[model samples]
Target: MAKITGETRLENVLVYMANMGRELIVADRCTVWLIDEAKQEVYTTVAHGVREIRIPAGTGLVGHAIASGEPIIIEDAYLDPRHNPDNDRKTGYVSKSIITIPFRNNDGTVIGAYQAINKMTETAKFTSKDMELLSLAASYAGKSLESVMLHQEIVDTQREIIATMGEIGEMRSKETGNHVKRVAEYSYVLALALGLSPKEAELLRTVSPMHDIGKVGIPDAVLNKPGKLTDEEYEIIKSHTRIGRQLLKGSRRELLRAASIVAEQHHEKWDGGGYPNGLKGEEIHVYGRITAVADVFDALSAERVYKAAWPLERIERLFREERGKHFDPAVVDAFFAKLPQLLDIRERLTDKG
Candidate 1:
């Protein structure tokens, strides 16, 4: 389960399963092939040192095992009629003993196949014990795969919700969806470079877009003013910080709670000149600091109702000059360090409208 949830990528989960299968079964190599019934294909996500592979369902020993929902063991793979030597030929691997097991879901539907090849033994033949271990592991893999998929679906749904809400916040203020997109990208890179785990980085990326969620609470007169805001209107607009926090409060979901922190503190400055509580330096939450840099960068890059987009030269010089003044010095460094990726994200998610 740690292996499954620890990974953000599905292929990485399959890679973990295959590597564990090979080690547990004492085989030279292993492959984890997930079935796509609609496509009638068995796609290999990971194979011992190989990149990937795919074949039609019921094509080889592994495929047949999956199609029939059965397990197969071969003392000599080359002698087995169902064995497919094409993979070995391509990978320059010699076929020997093999075992293929079908991984069935809770409903007893075969979802995938696990194959271990060339058992490492004096006789180079797989033992019954080897088959049993692999079978048990394959079953666990199937259940873990199910859990991982469900987790992925939940995460995707959460992302969709955050994106939609962020878009609403931006659109209400006359900003484009690309504004939120750039913020997420910039936050994502800063998070990773700051040494957060992949899972944490991904979470920060998803929720960072919600930094301006409180904007939805600001009156359109203050939020969408084409001209400079009056002093009264400025104070009213700044209340978006507390408003966003209140809007996102009380959610048990980690994403929402994290988003609340960003929304509440994204306006805070490192020098204690920022609004809300005026959290300064490390006094501000790291999430807030990271999102602040991302928010400011993207805001300056894009044209806004308040002002035109700043020239890149001015933006870069300001980042350098404002280090530790407006933005966190470390975060600024990470921003420049990952500037290329940040630029790529800007280009990739450029606003069409």
Candidate 2:
């Protein structure tokens, strides 16, 4: 119960509750079905040993429990008219005994159902006692699911806002939204190739799009200038990193903090020749180093207001030439290792005229 309620991710919460439901009911398998009220669908992802499934809100025994707000215990599932044997046919798992209990939020609204199949005991039947225990578990799971769903919604909204803000920054400098999308995907692939965990890699993907967010503060004249800039104008351009950092650094949220670091240090060179702070390799945050490679690659490959796009061969040659001088050697190696995925991203999100 502690672990189930503590989980902030909806998927994790569903898996934990499903495992708990199987144990509580002493069944061979359990599935936690969630109601997508807006879509009028009931879906289950952690269906124990079977493939995930989704159906209309009132389609099967589980859906009937949800709609009728009743707990059902059937000794022979095949004999029950409401039973949907299609899943059993698909998986080749015969179902004998079953228990489906509706779960509710604090308001007592039926949110979903818990279905436990094939009791493990000698009778091959779920008793009244089993239904009682499962009902108790379902009640707790309902509240937890509600909280986790809310958390997921908030996180998704935050990601959308960040991406939109990043796009605004890019658009100010005449770059397309696809530039940030490509960079985000490229950063994710590079992070994984460099041996970062999936969670860390996903974080990089979400925040790397903001690497040029500081450009939002740069004057349009200098930002869009086709001609080479004077030293003073160049200095002003360089300050975008600091400006971006300043805009995001104060946030207490981890997402924004990660974005702050990427915004400030994406231009920093491996040899300390780059950027607002000139922090060198290893000293620079990995997020910054990773974004630096992604940002530069996209900038060079895509057509921009000031310059034409470079050919793939020329861009590859520059990466090889720069090596440790311009980018962390490890990140650059990872970049090359995942070049195919990066190219696919470019193709998919390639700026549409």
Best candidate according to TM-score: 2
lDDT of each: 0.88, 0.90
- Model 2 clash pairs? none
Residue 223 accuracy (lDDT) in model 1 = 89
User: Compared to the true structure, candidate 1 yields what TM-score?
Assistant: 0.86
Off by over 4 Å in 2: 89-92
TM-scores of the candidates are 0.86, 0.93
List model 2 lDDT by residue over 1-353, tens digit each: 89996788888998899999998878999998878888899988679887779888898898898999999888898899998889888889998888999988878898788999999988888998898899889988898888888888888987998899999998999888898999999999999999999999999999988888899889999998999999999999999999999989888877899999999999999999998988998989999999999999999998887789999999899999988998999999998888988898899999887
Task: Name the top lDDT candidate.
Answer: 2
**Could you tell me how far off, in angstroms, the CA of residue 342 lies in candidate 2 after the best superposition?**
2.5
Tens-digit per-residue lDDT, 66-93, candidate 1: 8888899988888889988898899898
TM-score of 2: 0.93
